[model samples]
Structures are given as C-alpha cells and as structure tokens.
Target: MDRLTAFVSGAVQGVGFRWWTRSQALELGLAGSATNRADGRVEVVAEGPRPALEDLLARLGEQPSARARPGRVDAVVDLWTPARGVQGFRSR
Candidate 1:
C-alpha cells in the first residue's frame, strides 16, 4: 500500500471539494480523510495502492467537480506514512 497527503489550494473551500474527494476516494477504494484546513486549503490524506493514489491525484488536478473551475484548482502531494489504519474515505 501507498500513502499520500495532498494539500489542495485555490477556490477549494465551500465548493464541495471535500465531498468530491470523499466520493472519488471511495470509488477508488482508498482509505483516508479530506478536511478543510483553517488556512483555506483542503487537506487530503489517503492510503491505498500506488496506482489508485496516483489516479486520485490526477482526478483532483483535473477538477472532479463542476464547481472547480480552471485556474481555481491546484494541489501539492507528498508521500506519507500513516500512524494508524484508515478505515474508509471521509469528509471532515
């Protein structure tokens, strides 16, 4: 399994980013949580197959929702090591 933490910026908050992420992650069978950060960024941490993680990142960059417009979505991803098991994808 592979783990990744993605920090998504731009017009993310209040635009259903977290919900979109949760739906996509669940579809990919990834385990993680997508949360809104106090700094106006959305934080997504996921664990699953490397290919699935890569696919999730691609979907995020491609604007998974109609609410995410061009030049309004960006993400920074980093390899992560989870301290505990993530049961399922969630929105926070």
Candidate 2:
C-alpha cells in the first residue's frame, strides 16, 4: 500500500474539487479524504496501492471541473508507504 498527501493550489475551493477527488479516489479504490483549507487550497490524503495512488494523482492534476483549473500540486513526499486505518474516500 501507499499513502500520499498532496496540497493543491489554484481555483480549487468552491469549484467541486473535493467532490471530484472523492469520486476519483473511490473509483480507484483508494481510501482518503479531500478537504478545503482555509488558505485557499485543497488538501488530499490517499492510501492505497502505489499504482492506484499514482493514477489518482494524475486525475487530480487535471481540471476538477469546467470552472476549476489546478495550478500546482505539492506532494508532501515522493515516496509512499503503507498507512494503517484509512477507511474510505471522503470530502471534508
């Protein structure tokens, strides 16, 4: 399993980014959460197979919605390891 925490900036907040993330994560069978930060960014934490996580990251890099364009994605770590206790994908 792999865990990833990414901070995404740009027109993220209020543009359905969280929902889009949740949907994609679920489709990839990833467990995690996507939340809107007060500083105008979206924080996404996902745990799953490395390949699935990578695919999710790629999806997140795309436009979340017609009105939302992602500017940057800052992954906290380049490598991933198993993270215990994550259940299901969610928007928070």
Candidate 3:
C-alpha cells in the first residue's frame, strides 16, 4: 500500500469539503483523515493502492470544492505499512 498527502486549496473550507473527502476516501478504501488548516487550506492523508490514489487525485481535480479553491499540492506517495488498522475516514 501507499500513503498520499494532498494539500487542497481554494474554496476548500466550510463547504463540506472534509466530509466529502472522508466519504470519498472511504469509498476508495483509503485510510486516513482530512482537516482544515489554519490558513484555510485542506489537508488530506490517505493510504491506499497506487491506482486508487491516482484515481482519487483525478476525481478531486475534476470536482473542485464549492467553498474554497483547490491549489497545487505538495504531495508525497510512498510505500506505507499500516501500524494500526484504520476504522473509518474522519474530518479533524
């Protein structure tokens, strides 16, 4: 598996972005959480397979947030071993 981090920007806050992300991640069988940064950006850390991760990015790019804008991300995806099994996706 792999872990991916995405820093989503623009219209990403206060529009149910985190809730949407949590749902999407869970649907994609990803493990992690999404949260709003103090600077009004959204942060996501998801762990899943490569293809699925790519798919998630594609989907996110296709569907921009309604409240905040999504900007370029400083993302890193690498081999990830889950220490504790994830129960569900959440917004933090």
Candidate number with the higher lDDT (1 or 2):
1
Which scores better on lDDT, 2 or 3? 2
| Residue pairs in collision within model 2 | none
- Tens-digit lDDT string for candidate 1 (43-87): 899999888988888887875445343335766656566435678
**Model 1 TM-score, all chains together:** 0.82
Q: How far is candidate 2 from the true structure (C-alpha RMSD, Å)?
A: 3.7
TM-score of each: 0.82, 0.79, 0.73
How much is 8 displaced in model 2, in angstroms? Answer: 0.5
In terms of TM-score, the best-performing candidate is: 1
10 residues in a row with least lDDT, candidate 3: 72-81
Candidate 2: lDDT over CA atoms? 0.75
Q: Model 3: what TM-score? A: 0.73
Write the residue-wise lDDT of candidate 3 on 1-92 in tens digits.
77777777667778776887787887888888888899877877787787787767665666433424344333323333443445567799
TM-score of 2: 0.79
Each model's backbone clash number:
0, 0, 8
**Over 4 Å off in model 1, which ranges?**
63-71
Model 2 misplacement above 4 A: 63-81
Please list all clashing residue pairs in model 3, or write none if there are none. Answer: 9-69, 9-70, 10-68, 10-69, 11-67, 11-68, 11-69, 12-68
Worst 10 residues of 2 by lDDT: 69-78
